[model samples]
Target chain A: METAFTPFTSFGGGLAIGLGAVLLMLGLGRIFGATGIMSGAVFITSRAELSWRLALIAGMVLAPVTLFFVTGQMPVLNVPVSPTMIVIGGVIVGLGASLGSGCTSGHGVCGLSRLSVRSLVAVPTFMVTAAITVFIIRHVFGA
Target chain B: MKLFYALITGLVFGIGISLSGMMDPAKVLNFFDLAGTWDPSLAFVMGGALIVTFVGYRLVWRRDAPLFEARFRIPTGTAIDRNLVGGSALFGIGWGIAGFCPGAAIPALGTGRWEVALFLLAVTAGFYLRRLLAPMQTARAAS
Candidate 1:
């Protein structure tokens, strides 16, 4: 599929994300980090703590499905990697997100917004590395 | 109340991710492809989110505590260690390779695509594996 820059959609979606994050912080007193929430839902020892996490995941899983009903179209997805590459990428992402303590949502949006110093350092590191990796794969290897 | 709040937050977030075009791997890849056909839409998404959260957090922090929680569950780690840097680098490479970060990946499952299912499985495995390895790492350090 051909790529296009969508400023309005991006901005609108961003506004929703920001509103969601703010609501989470104010209502639940928690950072809206996907990996952290997922991990907690799956691995937490206490069942009480698990309820909200599961609710969050359930809501996320339902959102696009709801959108499909409302708009009569499935959300656009463009996974361009091979099976092997996808597995490798997914594993690395899971491990890295866990080890790094946050992903784009936690570090990039919420953490940065909170003015966390660690997130300040992390965002640039990942962004630059991601840029270089894309350059290597797209230009150098020509994959 | 907290569960309801979490559900709403997740719903908003999922919608935002879908609308922002972040769910599209091609768009995400284009964002990373600075030297190629770079699309800056994700920047606007991030910018919009940052502005809202930046202001919203300050307003929320003024409160003594959240409505449903005792206190905020904020990360307190301040040190910049090898784990943070290395993990972030790994995440960046994975993101560059697959164009699916945690935030995008979860909601992508709503698309019911095989590739997304595979990626989700790998991500779950990666999270569990990290948990499995954490104890060993701590033991090795103690030894």
Candidate 2:
């Protein structure tokens, strides 16, 4: 797959993400953890709140879609792995996020900003583990 | 007023990160191409993030509590115990291999990447696994 980078585009994406985190934190009195949002949708009881959650999730899922359609510049996939491996990876990440009580957004962005210790630990843990795993896959196993 | 400001701040953060392109998977993947053609774009992203965070923290630190909340909610513990280390290791491995953390993964799905779907599933599984194993791990440690 071909890949390139542009400063303006990168800046736009970051701005949206940061703004989303801030908005979620301020309005709902909650952290914008992806896993948490999924969990809330799965478990919450109220219909009104459920709609808002659904809307939030929808926004996240659609934002890139809109970008792709409008720009005709589909985001390239950098991963080189089988569907099965990808699925396996997803399951593992899901479990980890739940165990950690938040995903990157909740902890990495909101939690870290709030200076939550759990997030501080979790963010670096996420970063380091991911780095080592990449090393092994790309170098050691040659996968 | 505090809550209002918090909401506005949240929006700014969310929009800001998105605009910065930090949410884009391909852009982030460029950071990992170190051995071949390493993309230095992420360094810029990090630089921007650090500056934002540094300034943001400095300003926020003055207040006893966050604008919308009762307390700042900073973590009290400073221990780098087993839980922190182990959890981080797992997270790093996943991210290194996949090149997508939870924050970026969700937006990636908007681009119709099957791999993003797979990674998200793994993340979910990891969360549950941690929950299931936590008690046992704790019990074993006690003994």
Candidate 3:
């Protein structure tokens, strides 16, 4: 398989993500964890906090279309998993995120930035496991 | 005001994820394939984000309060428990299988893909499942 390495775009996009996270922290006093925000929007009893959560998710959903207008091209997302596999993956991710209390953005980006010890442990654990899974699936299973 | 800020932050985050090609599962999976055809661009993405957020957090923490809220809602957990490790391990496997973390998955929904939709549905179900299981665990502990 050919490798696709685009450092410029990746770095630029990363900066934007960091900026977005910082903005959320400084402006709203909230951690920019997608799962947390999404779950809050879905399950929270407080109606007052719902609007911002909905807005954030709506913005995320519309971003691709907004980019389409700016760049005249849609993002290419090639998910190489079957429908069943995708559903199973999603369930595990959702459950794990809830139990772990954060996802990539929460634990990987924000938590690391804050120098949290638990995130420090969680990030490496997940990254290593992710690598192992990929190795098994692609190399051993040859899927 | 808070809603506006959240919307803007989320939009920027979505665009960043799209531009960084993090939304592409193949690229994400390639990053995990270190022994095979490894792409190190994602590392740069994380690095760039981490640096900005590291600095951003330090500066933001200097302020007494957020611009729009009374207090910052940072995580206070400090334990390295089974839930953290086990949940992270499960999340990593799911991420490796699908290459779609919560951040990327939310934005991918804009593409209107059936697989994305299915995965999201499963994610919601998983969230509810976890919610339902929490009380059972509490009951068992109490007993």
- How well does each candidate superpose onto the true structure, as a TM-score? 0.95, 0.72, 0.96
Q: What is the CA-based DockQ of model 2?
A: 0.33
Q: How many clashes in candidate 1?
A: 0
Q: Proportion of native contacts in model 3?
A: 0.79
Worst 10 residues of 3 chain B by lDDT: B111-120
Local accuracy of candidate 1 as per-residue lDDT tens digits, B3-105: 8878888888888888898888889989988878889999999998999999999999999999888998888888898778887888888888878888887
Model 3 docking tier (incorrect/acceptable/medium/high): medium
DockQ of 3: 0.80
Interface root mean square deviation per prediction: 1.1, 4.4, 1.1
Candidate 2 falls in which docking quality class? acceptable
Tell me what fraction of the real C-alpha contacts between chains A and B each candidate also makes.
Answer: 0.78, 0.39, 0.79
Clashing pairs in 3: none
lDDT of 1 at A134: 90
Q: What iRMS does model 3 reach?
A: 1.1
lDDT of 1 by residue, A84-132 (tens): 9888888888888888888899999998998888888888989988899
In candidate 1, which residue ranges exceed 4 Å CA deviation?
A: none
